[model samples]
Target chain A: MLAASGKLDRRELCRALLADRGDLLVVAGLGAPAWDITAVGDRAENFPLWGGMGGAAMIGLGLALAQPARRVLVITGDGEMLMGLGALATIAVQRPANLSIVVQDNEHYGETGMQETHTRHGVDLAGMAKAAGFPRTMLVTRPEEVPALRAAIHAGEGPLFAVAKVDPSTLPLVLPPREGAYLQARLREAVLGPAAHHQL
Target chain B: MDRQVMESRPAAADWPDGLYELLKTHRIRQVAVVPDAGHARLIRRCLADNGMRVVSLTTEEEGIALLQGAWLGGDKGVLLMQSSGVGNCVNMLSLAITHRTPMPMIVTMRGDFGEFNPAQVPMGSATQAVLEAMGALVRRADRPEDVVPTADATIRLAFNTFRPTATLIGQRVIGAKTFGKD
Candidate 1:
């Protein structure tokens, strides 16, 4: 659907951001973003929403609020972010310093026949987030700027928002565990230690 | 944890106050909510307490995912909203069903049993059934005195069993909204 493709490969960008991720809790939006996170390798700290469409950012907000000491990151596609744009305002009001949101703007809904999303029509998500009171917002289109975005996620005062323009190439699907209950328990055990592992 | 402001009084225990105390006793720290007139008293009471963090939402679905995240971080939470907000939460409730997230929702009724507006009827009547269809256990507290006890039970049911539960405070308890003439 896009005539001029973005230079950055989404898989490489996700791999770069997750490298050396220490105590960072990740929430990946459903669809391509979830696949991207899973491709990098699944960790207990990583929560990929297998179905829920508009919840990644708010989930990051809640986790950040509950654990201020740890960093929280949400990686979502443009279509997913647009679906839950109101969450940015709610998250801004709370201003959880540990939270960061990154939107992979491919301008097309990759899972759904590459339908053109709002981002394709110059809908600026970074601008909206900046207006919503996020202290730091970035629009990264060049390859060199990826490091800054990663640094902001790993070690920066946030709730930061970033939208990375990525190439809309159809890639192989990398799925996480399909069972939500198992994934939920896995995360609790990781974050809360062995004690959180309770019988159903 | 400022329990003194919200508590330190057993004499004048209304249902809202009792419910507030119940949340504190249950160790619920995150109050994921969408504001509603029926729940004003308890919402204000929660905001007043230093121990509770009332995270307001633009819509009700955010609360479900927010609570799911809270559980990941080892903190418990509760969702407070009105009956109509339940419609907004249908798709999002799947996270709780599939993940078995422990979520307790305290909903104040708007359209049931003497509602003024006809617009409130559809979702209000559908609230319990919708939640049940989504695999969330449902209960109702139609009397003022029963609100706290039912809420407490539902909270235990949710956390202990890792199931999503909703406790509906009936419109009769809220004394259905009236226009200027009435």
Candidate 2:
């Protein structure tokens, strides 16, 4: 009995959030979030996870810590976030200012035939993140809040945690590079330029 | 933070220092760890080193993704954990295996030599075999002097050969954890 209060269209929100992205590295969680990111536009910097479900946020943390000069965003689903909730504590401890985690909370496990997730009941991911010591945390329900959330992500003074409640309607699949090696090489080449060739 | 290596006790041995130097030589900037006494010295050294980005993970499985992301970003990283933590990483090891991402893990073993805790025995005994089963090249360092060479081979295997490699720091090198001590 989840309320249908989410007014923001996920694809539009993703498009708006990533419209001005320039050299920003994105790690998309498995299933829906990956499609959301891909729907916006696929690039060498956008790493959409096909298998690593709960590992997106930590991967974002690693990328953020490694490339301090660049902005790192982790766009994931509520189910995925819940599975890797401990990552919030770890990310809070590291406090990499370049990192931002955005959860597309559709209140359902969309990939597995749209079953209700914990967020549909009473799970508060943003609250959990704030309790875990993230400096900035937000819950965006309305489309108007998207701008502020985008600003926070680009502000570069974060360990920001945001959960955007989106419609539970499923969208068409948008697949990125299926080969892990290709995705890895594309990202490396984009980040390190000619120096990537020298690495293993 | 100051770069001084924290513990100065001679009894602590130089194996941790040897491994630290090897990591530095390989330009490993990211260190993902779940704390354990056996890895304390190495963890502290990485934390104090200004050039290294030390990520304290809640679980060892997180290290797999972190290191994969590090490699994706054109940087190198290592996972420091105890043998017990190896059990936590089995499933996530597929991320490295399927992706063909190079991962170097430094594990301090338990339940092998003078182990007082029976809880650590099961996982400790299964650690090397588990890592090997997950397609990681496993090596062991039984003595203080063997640390550097084992780490060297592991690094070469991981980074150069594009394969996941692990070096198990033997109980003899790290010393057994006493029950009624501190």
All candidates: TM-score: 0.94, 0.92
Cα TM-score of candidate 1: 0.94
lDDT of each: 0.89, 0.88
Off by over 4 Å in 1: A1-6, A198-200, B1-13
Error of 2 at A86 (Å): 1.3
Which pairs clash inside model 2?
none
lDDT of 1 at A167: 93
Clashes of each: 0, 0
Candidate 1 per-residue C-alpha lDDT over B1-182 given as tens digits, one digit per residue, 9 for 90 to 100: 48864563342348887888899999999999999888888999999999989999999999998998898888899999999999999999998888888999999998898888899999999999999999999899987777888999999999999989999999898888878647
Model 1 agreement with the true structure over A1-200: per-residue lDDT tens digits: 12246468898889889989998989999998889999999878889988778888988888898889999999999998998888999999998999999999999999989999999999999999999999999998887888888999987599999999999998798889888888888888878788886633
TM-score of 2: 0.92
User: Candidate 2: which stretches are off by over 4 Å?
Assistant: A1-6, B1-13
